[model samples]
Target: MTGEGIKECELIEWHIKEGDVVAEFDRICEVQSDKAAVEITSRYAGTVRRLCHEPGAMVQVGEALLEVEVADEPEEEEDAAAASALGPMPPVQQLAPAEQAVKREQAGLAATLASPAVRRVAREHGVDLASVQGTGPSGRIYKEDVLRLVEAASEEVPGPSLQHKLPEQRAEQLSRPAPSAAGLPAAAEDVIIPLRGYARTMVRSMTAAGAVPHFHYCDELDAGPLLAARALLASDPALGGARLTFLPFVLKALTVALAEFPVLNSSLSADGKALLQHAAHNIGVAMATPTGLVVPNVKAVQGRSVAGVAAELARLQAAAAAGRLGPEDLAGGTLTVSNIGAIGGTYASPLVNPPEVAIVALGRVREVVRPAPGGGFMTASVLAASWGADHRVVDGATLARFSNVWKALLEEPRRLLLHLR
Candidate 1:
């Protein structure tokens, strides 16, 4: 809810449970919305009184997630501020109507009861907790019991293949193969795995993007200067071991072009009446991760040096790989650049990222023979660039001219220094 337009969110996990004492600003929970995974923190010093919702439950904006028993103090105004921070209580909704009932019923069984950690272990090993004999007090299962069950089951199996020996209940769930989202039921052969998490977010974003009118422009540029520029920067001592890639050069060149043609660095107003031109060139770089594609932008790219942009790019990549990207990292992108070249492509008609009016994707560079300025044919390193823009706002001539400006800066990177502050 920190950013606009996100109405619903899925609570990923809680950092503290009931009765846990917490200080102001302590991490409360991690939640995922349409944009990015965000960490909710405590604004009041208190003890966790009750958890209003469970993990994976969807809650709407301005809803009270949990009840906190704030420590009573003489400062009445401070206590009132804390109370204001806590939103009104609202109903929490789950993806499946029967999930809560099923979880409660399972927890009621003492004979098969197991802690979450132990249950997770059993699930990973395909050992049903009902089959593991509880060794703890009151017939409660423990981690050791699950491990023993796994070991004993492995001994009975002739080879490393344990799929055939999975507990009946585990095997049944696997055979059904339906989870996360609504999908078709499974049989012996086919299994329908519904998209969730980033995959789901991507679907929503792309669907929204398609509703807007789009036009594409494609051209190839001689990348001889771009390659040589990267080589020169790679050895710079001031860069301090930052991975010098063509991305930073491309980003810097983009900023130079964006400075002259700021209309491309704009988003359509919600009412579709006014075109909101952003002053800062917060350019997003489309990245591919294990989960899905995420565009985390560098703020104020026009103000940052090529080296500075490279450092931030590296930081974003590492944060994305670790799933630590926050709402700030994903929001406020005015325009985007996708290096499709890294993935072995030379051109792409990418959908313009919603809100932003345009996106540029770079294709793989190749050596080809072309006419030299001296007139004869010569071999040149060329990189393909594709541009997709909101045809409603940006005309073909504007994007073409903008693309030319970008191409000029990237081709002769030395010109980038003129615009450097």
Candidate 2:
């Protein structure tokens, strides 16, 4: 089952079927929804009685996923022990409201009931989550509750400062389906298709990301020295013949910059308080896959050389293309590098994926004429780098300074050796 408003999922593949013996924690099937592609595991050791749904069927969360006839020997006195233990306990009707709030069997939060998405929205609007009543499963605070409070607050705009309403307007616009040619004329046979799986997931995730205040910083780097460096590295047998691209160099330099300015390598805690500066730089690189786009990081790039980064990146790209990336591969992305240049874009304003304070878009290399250091005009290859950062955490000077470090390394490729380790 999926969380955060996902009530059902499309069965992508079933690893087990009718009469297959399953052990506890064994993966039985994989399902995809707007939230993610997850493997459903078995909780009991038993033989499957039935396969309720076929591949590609939509299954509800509350419905019987599959039947299990326990294969383990039963404990005969278990029912009697449970009844005797409960008989000595008072019912909830006899307890006070404060006393009733105690965890019945498991330890958890007292009354906090909001998903990450809901909590993020509430934090943005300065809504007190504790005061908002929850109406979802297990008293989870839904997105509607956060929006209700925001709308009520917007009703009291006393002056003509409409800027206060811009956030809501942008959110409403983003909520609509983005068509490639939205202004084109419609025909009688024009069909409206609903987003599913990866596309649907992108919409929801990006929608939440859109709520964040973002700032973009643009700069151009001379790629002349960088290209020469790549050629030199290509001849090294230590690279293991891994395909070398501009991304590895870009990522390698980014890590060097991050080591100096650790703030950019951090994420806000769940409650939107305190900063978590990660010791390891698990840098995520966006790659296209057979299923969709996946940003699996080259874990601990801070400790790897440029050649190592290339090798690790090759492995991740292969895994993504095969649809074999696990949850660990997809999660824990502290920062991301979107190589829009690979797909032929010259400039991009990439959105900052939440929990990641920053993202840099690498643009296609181009030839440009510039003044030489010795005074004559020189022709050089250049790449444009545009960075988008969460304004709540990153400021212009910090990002610019960080970019300068990255720029120095790329502009003068030999500088990377000093930080290569």
Candidate 3:
């Protein structure tokens, strides 16, 4: 599994179990980080002796995950002779009475039939191996049995420690109504599905976004030229019938504006004493996946032409919807753009993805009546553009100026072509 900046991940499932023979590079388990779920593969061919962690356990990077019993490689004659000269090894110690009893209950082995990994899991959850019934060969306890015990315990009491409650108080707590689901009152027939994986991560990230000193800057852009540009691109044979969208134009314009206002392309240091300016214009495009929302950025957008940006955006959107986005695709974003307009929103104060200073939201393009130079009202296509910036690094005035530049480029779509790489 890829760790990179991830410190720990929840063990989601095990593909290989104890006593199962696995080949090198065979997928052994699935672990989910905040960003994505990844499959962990075996590094050596061997029989799985024990699973170190159970499903739903938070395992840290570099931790031993499982124990494997592999045959030792043959040693050379010189090494064997050197080992023999060192004399015979000492005898193994006998088990204590309590240990002997535990060994008998768990399985009749020289040591506890459970491996160190399984023991670690049992210790973490305070599960007694002597009480659990093992289904493995020779009554060897497995990780699944421990998980089943934990799940059963959780279902008996859904929340809070009732042990300290008085008899009357416990009755009152149990009589209270169950919590709502998805902000709606639960009907008797409603199925309560808990958020997990990407959805859970999104909730945490959005909560952190709320804690940042943030402000919004919104303005309308004349979308007549943008719409024209889209039409022109759609007619070009070079496009190969690929659907051209307003997102590439918006992304390109934002990249150009970022070059002018470099502060918007930087993140604040953790201590808030310094600004970290990124050299590349990696702009994240927010897209909704079936499981949750994901923002996989197009790297180095400052160097890509409109067509290139469009191609990359299409690739990323497809990968994200299919839940196949790689770690790199979801990282290194200096700014983000959320096209809520595609979903029929007029405007939204999109949340800033942390470490980045700003995010821009594009609302749907619609017709608006405005005064013409001749003093007559004329209808023009317009888009509501909203900007959210971390106020710690970007002042209101700086964000306003940046938005003006982005809006201007979109209003005069030809200006964007001049700046394209």
Best by lDDT: 1
lDDT of each: 0.77, 0.73, 0.76
Model 3 ranges off by over 4 Å: 5-22, 27-31, 46-130, 135-173, 177-186, 189-195, 235-237, 240-242
Descending-lDDT candidate ranking:
1, 3, 2
For residues 1-421, write the lDDT of model 2, one tens digit per residue: 3555666676778898788888888888887764457777775677776564577655655444565666544452222111110012111132344453464223454336454445656765666676676654345456677778667767776543334334655466558586687678865632335456666667766897898899999999999899988887886888898988778888889899998999999988778888898888889988876556667888888889888999988888877676556667767888999988987967788898778889999999999899999998999998999999989899999999999999998998888888776
In order of listing, the candidates' clash counts read 0, 0, 2
Q: Which parts of model 2 are misplaced by more than 4 Å?
A: 1-8, 16-27, 33-50, 66-196, 269-273, 372-377
Clashing residue pairs, candidate 2?
none
- List, residue by residue over 204-284, the lDDT tens digit for candidate 3: 889988989889888998899889889878767655555689888888998999889999999888898999999999999
Displacement of residue 78 (Cα, Å) in model 3 is 30
What lDDT does model 2 reach? 0.73
lDDT head-to-head 1 vs 2, winner: 1
C-alpha root-mean-square deviation, each candidate: 10.1, 13.4, 8.3
Candidate scoring better on TM-score of 1 and 2: 1
Q: Candidate 1 residues 131-181, lDDT tens each?
A: 767753334456678888777877887675545334654466558744666
TM-score of each: 0.66, 0.64, 0.73
